[model samples]
Target: MTTRDPAARLLRLLSLLQSRTDWPGPELAGRLGVSTRTIRSDIERLRNLGYPVAATPGTAGGHRLGSGARLPPLLLDDEEAVAVAIGLRTAAAQAVGGIEETSLRALTKLEQVLPARLRPRVAALAASTVPLPGNGPAVDGDVLTALAVACRDRRRVRFDYHDHKGNATLRDVEPHRLVSTGQRWYLVAWDIDRNDWRMFRIDRLRPRTPMGPSFPGRSLPPGEAIDFVTKGVASTLEPCRTVATVHAPVTAVSERVPPVARVEHLDDQRCLLHIGAAAPLTLAVYLAALGLPFTVDGPPALLEALRRMSQHCAGAVSPATPAMSASQPRADAW
Candidate 1:
């Protein structure tokens, strides 16, 4: 059986090749419902159109799509086209520094070719959504690319890193993984000199030339890379830290706090929360906002801050109303 419309058949053939790494001539013919001879002609037609479709010889030979000097038009289904459009729009607004403009350019080109049916859906989404401009420092595109390549190939990289106090030091590490938390990028790696795992902010490091030899991959620290980076970043950035006993279960407390805060279960009904902020007042406000029953021990400053907050709340109430009930343990209960 052969397709009556040659153009439609060629599109189906292209889609099939793009979907997988290899396809035997007979298999391609069977799937397309065409003769092997017709498959050969279709393959030639695709090649003539600048698609780098590579063919192999011999009984076990097959065809595969290989990288070419230029990119050809891609075949995307309705859902795929919309997804790409939305992704590009998001990247344009919040991606690492240099790619924003490039993303917009690509989006414009895609919109031009998008089927008329999808235009309004994409437009409505773009119009209704707004991305907050990221205030975090921008990462250099070249440095990002170099680190990505090193991680992919399991190679060692040396870089100059600046700590929070502005002290500069040289670092040599085995690349492990890159983690992004919407606002910043972090590299989780094994520090050769420290003999331990370390997380480095991508924006704060400058990659040195001549990458070191390939390395054997090491197991990442206990949890997911994102969690490791989050905990490390919070500890490094905030000077004041404390642990509190939250009356709610771990699952309940986890939902209210940022991922940077660590939550551990103590029992079925109680959990521990490890959190930090620049000052005791800030921490007080954060706990108060939780609206959960919790208790904090000394870090005398935090206790005093909570006492002050309690007074403030008491003072705000009217004398006519009964004294604020204190039977329950709350953030300001002290």
Candidate 2:
């Protein structure tokens, strides 16, 4: 970690400072193979180049990189450069309202400066990757930024929200975390008036300026934020709910179901799937589409729906076609 070239030494020093919040002066000197006086000089040089290098003077004094008025050039290694480039490329295809263009601009700049050896790897990835078209509405970037800031500061927010039925109402809430379900964005927060935790659709809410007063953070309801939002959304949209014993590994079942459906591991050969839909028939159809063997442990209605579906499917088959035995494990039957 020692360098004789002054410019290279300064760049190495900057990288070290950025890697951690604080470093003892002696440790910095030792790492750079320089005296403490030389480390002090290097710190000054970094500051002159627009890097806010803060120093504390004393026996145990250290140096730290602080926030500056403007961003300075970052020194990223080969791996970091590739990672950033790929991340930006992926983000460029997302449905986040105004971020696609910005992400593309950043990706372009990053690729232009990437080391020659790394350029091919990044270019090949960009050439091979394809993102699915997002079906969700675009979320306002300004609103997203404001909500993030409020959540970080634990501040109350006032916004006008529209319900599923298109009813508009004013809401004051203590901002929590924002969750993205790939198709849509949701805000998980505590409602001031309702005195309960609620999940709001980000695209349907307009944040009011001059947010409400700062509030003490509250412990989120059981499970992670994503779990809470998904469950809430499912309950609201689908009234019929049931659990099924799916005869498949958890990973396989997880890959087949949507995020709104919760899958619990039972054993190596089976898992429990908790899901809901507007009607028992709809749920039955969804399960059948999985093309996997499963048995429903549900309300009588769901079982009845599956019974009717089986009969209809059997009738549709030609009489000459061999019938499946009752005990046979059909890969496409549930």
Candidate 3:
């Protein structure tokens, strides 16, 4: 004779119930490797959790989960549910290219099912979310779903990608993961065409059909998928990369910067930056606007350009004495 722990046995019963539509008392006992008596007790625990489990007796009898009149006990606590609702609502605003509509639909359903006590908190959080402007083009939500599926199912994806310079190329990749980096999303995968790993910003992709075939997956390299994409997108992939010596501590400007931009501290008052932007002039203007003094490091042209712009913004760039500063506080003051 064997005796199984009650709670563990109860969880096993729930797992059995979730796996199929119906199971006879004997069948459940056999699967759990427990006795018929234990199976009956496990059913009690599930019922306590609000699962609408029903049983019929005799040879035709079995255990089945029925539709309940109310929501079952969920795994998440109040704070967790509120966070999920807020995140989904935020996603709906992103209406990312392919999935906005679906996100809105899912969010609507989740919000509808919220319990009376949690409703206000979820509602308030959803109402207060404000989405900022996004870069990267509109990405189709369907693409996200498809990529996600491929990752989960260990399948392959084929798509046409448009590069930074607007060059189109066909690709076949084994999608290992999806990475959302602020305004944009990316996929990290093993590229079939190049025979190497690569990262793609989802908006820049146009998936090709008949999709692609699943392949044997390999372990992903160190680092999170999103960080890998962040480094790729914010680094040298753009038209140009610029490094500037900003005369400010890294901490002072870290929060005000984008993830694509990198900063290294220079003593207590200066930091070096590695940043990418579409145009050299645009890059120069951005650094000049940082409100901190900086020395342009390279691409001699950019240095000369920054100097010229500095002269253009001479009055704007200079600090006025505290008295003169306020009549017109320096736009660069902050």
Q: For residues 1-334, could you state the per-residue lDDT of candidate 3 as single tens digits?
A: 2336776666566766766788999988887788787788778778887788999989989999887877653445577778888778777667376466777887888778888999988777657766776665677777888888989898888888987778889888999988776667788999987988899878889887665666886977536565668668876455667778887788876655667777778788888887767777777877767777777667876777777886786666547534454567565521
Winner of 2 and 3 under lDDT: 2
Give the RMSD in angstroms, all C-alphas superposed, for model 1: 4.7
lDDT of 2 by residue, 1-334 (tens): 6678999999899888888899999999999999989999989998888889888888877999999988867889889999999899888887789899999999888888888999899989978988888889999999999999999998999999999999999999998999988888999999999999889999999999998789988998536788999898899888999989999999888988888999999999999999999999999998988887999767999999999999999889997988779998755422
Candidate lDDT scores, in order, read 0.88, 0.90, 0.76
Question: Worst lDDT window (10 residues) for model 2?
Answer: 325-334
How would the candidate models be sorted by TM-score, starting from the highest?
2, 1, 3
For residues 170-190, could you state the per-residue lDDT of candidate 1 as single tens digits? Answer: 999999999887778899999
Best by the TM-score measure: 2
* lDDT value for model 1: 0.88
- List residue ranges in candidate 1 displaced over 4 A: 56-61, 221-223, 249-252, 265-270, 317-334
Ranking by lDDT: 2, 1, 3
> Which residue ranges in model 3 land beyond 4 Å of their true spot?
1-75, 108-120, 123-128, 162-168, 204-228, 234-237, 247-249, 265-270, 316-334
